[model samples]
Target: MKQIVARGALAGLLAGVVAALVSVLIVERPMRAALVIEDARPAAPGARGGDLFSRPTQVVGGMVAAVVVAVLIGIVFAVVYRWVAERVHRQSAFARSLHLAAVGFAAIVLLPMVKYPGNPPGVGDPDTVDQRTNMYLSLIAAGLVLAVLAHWAYRALAKRNWPGPMRGVVAAGGAIVLAGVALAVWPANPDPIPPDVPAALLWQWRLASLFELAALWAALGVGFGLLVDSSARRWAAGQRAAVAPT
Candidate 1:
């Protein structure tokens, strides 16, 4: 268990580093371009820059933060892998890791994002930050709850003698409907973008943000699976050697 966790963490660290680089290269460059446009606008009297540090400093700081966050997420992934090992019947470490990562991306990213999508900097009203933050967090929590319920529903329905594909279809369909209902009931966020902000820039920035997250998950899933599989093979070889007549 300890070894598994260590390997997972190492994989996560690597993934995070890769993600940070992606952000710096692909995401941040466009963001800075947008910021240049924003800075050209006339500021309200007494309006000041958000950060004390310069752009380069912030970029480096963001990379460091991304790595730290990735390590933490890796630990969580390790723990989840252990938990899922008991409940799921995946035959290989890679399969199990991929499954978990897919489910995670759905629950954590896709679901909530449908309701409250990502926005680029300067897109949101500062006054509504608290309200938006609360709503976003609530949606994420609700999405996770729905994911858990969906898994439980699948398990419960599996106990019945229904055909496998049929059961999956029914379970997944029900979950999707429930998620849709949840989204429908939730209040929509107001469009907070100023008229001066280019729609094209906003669209591209949002896409970049989503891509950054996708990259992180993809890297973590594949990297962790490789590490776990390699470790398992080594352990099996050691065990076989110990048991062999020598």
Candidate 2:
């Protein structure tokens, strides 16, 4: 168990580094270009850039933050894998890791994003920032809870000898229905973009943000699988050596 944890942590760190690179090279570069266009748009006499840091500083800081977030997420993936390994039937580590990653992406990214899509800087109203933040957080919390309930429902049904397809259908359908209800109850975020802002820039920035997340999750899944596979192979080799007559 200790070895597994250590390996998982190492895998997560490496994966995080890769993810950070992807964000910096692929996502941030394009996003910065889009932001420049946004900044060039005319502003009122008293207007100023609504940034805490200069563009270069923001880019470097964002890369660092991405790496840190990826590392933490990797550790979480390790812990989750450990917990699920014992409870679930034996399966290839890659398959299990991928499955977990898919569920995680759905719960953490896809669902919340559907309700509160990402926006570029200067795209939200300052007056309602607090409200928007709270609403987004609530959506994330609700999505996570629904994901857990769906998992539980699937397990419960499986234990009762329910058909596998039927169990999956019920679990998935229930979660979707619950999520729909939540979405209906939640207040929509008001559009904050002024008439002069370019819609193309906003769209590009939002798409880049989503791409960054997709890259991070993909790295986590693939990296975890490779680590687990390598570890298993080494363990098997050691076992074989121990049994061999010297």
Candidate 3:
């Protein structure tokens, strides 16, 4: 378990660095475009506007934030992998890691974005920040609940001797339905997009952000699975060596 966790952390660290690079390369262009709108706003009408740090500093901070968040997610992934090992016993380590990563992305990123897509900085109204935060949190928590139920649905179907492919489709479909239901039930963000924020730029930034996050999770999952699989093979070989007669 300890070794698995260490591997997870290492994978996450590497993945985070990759994500940060993606942010700079892919996400930053759209973000800079949005910042142009911000600069033109009446309140802050200059190049250096609306923050303590310049764009360079903000970019560095964003990279650091990505690394920290990835490490935390890696720790959580390791813990969850332990919990779900029995449920995914037949899958290879790589497959299991990827399946879990998809679940994490769906619950934490996709579901919430269905209703309240992300905005680059300087887009939202300041007055309703609290309301927006609460709404986003509520959706994230609800999405997690739906994921749990989907897992339960898979287990229940398995007991009834359902085919593996059928079980997976059913579980995934049920989760999607539940997410839609949550979107219907949950309140929308109180704050609307500002008039100045262009829809094209908004979506561009959002797509980049989504892709960056998905990349982070994908990298971690693959790296962690490879490390774990290699470790397991080594341990198995050692066990065989121990039992062999001299």
Q: Which segments of candidate 3 are over 4 A away from where they belong?
A: 44-50, 231-246
Tell me, by TM-score, which candidate is best: 3
Model 2 scores worst on lDDT over the 10 consecutive residues at: 29-38
lDDT of each: 0.82, 0.79, 0.86
TM for every model, in the order presented, reads 0.87, 0.82, 0.88
lDDT of 1 by residue, 1-246 (tens): 898789788978988999899899889967987787778778869988566998999999999999888888888999989888888773588878887787777778888888888876667778888988888888778877887787788778778866767867887788789889989988889766788778888788888888888888888887888788776657767989999998
Cα RMSD to the true fold for all candidates = 5.6, 5.7, 6.2
Candidate 2: count the clashes. 0
Error of 2 at 25 (Å): 3.1
Candidate numbers sorted by TM-score from highest down: 3, 1, 2
lDDT of 3 by residue, 1-246 (tens): 897788788888988999999999999999899888877767734545357988899999999999988988898898888788867788878678888888888899888888898899887777888888899988999988988999999999999999999999999998888788889988877767888888889899999999998899888887777777866557667989999999
lDDT for model 1 comes to 0.82
Q: Please, what are the lDDT tens digits per residue for candidate 2 over residues 29-49?
A: 557766776687778688774
The superposed Cα distance between candidate 1 and the true structure at residue 86, in angstroms, equals 0.6
Best by lDDT: 3
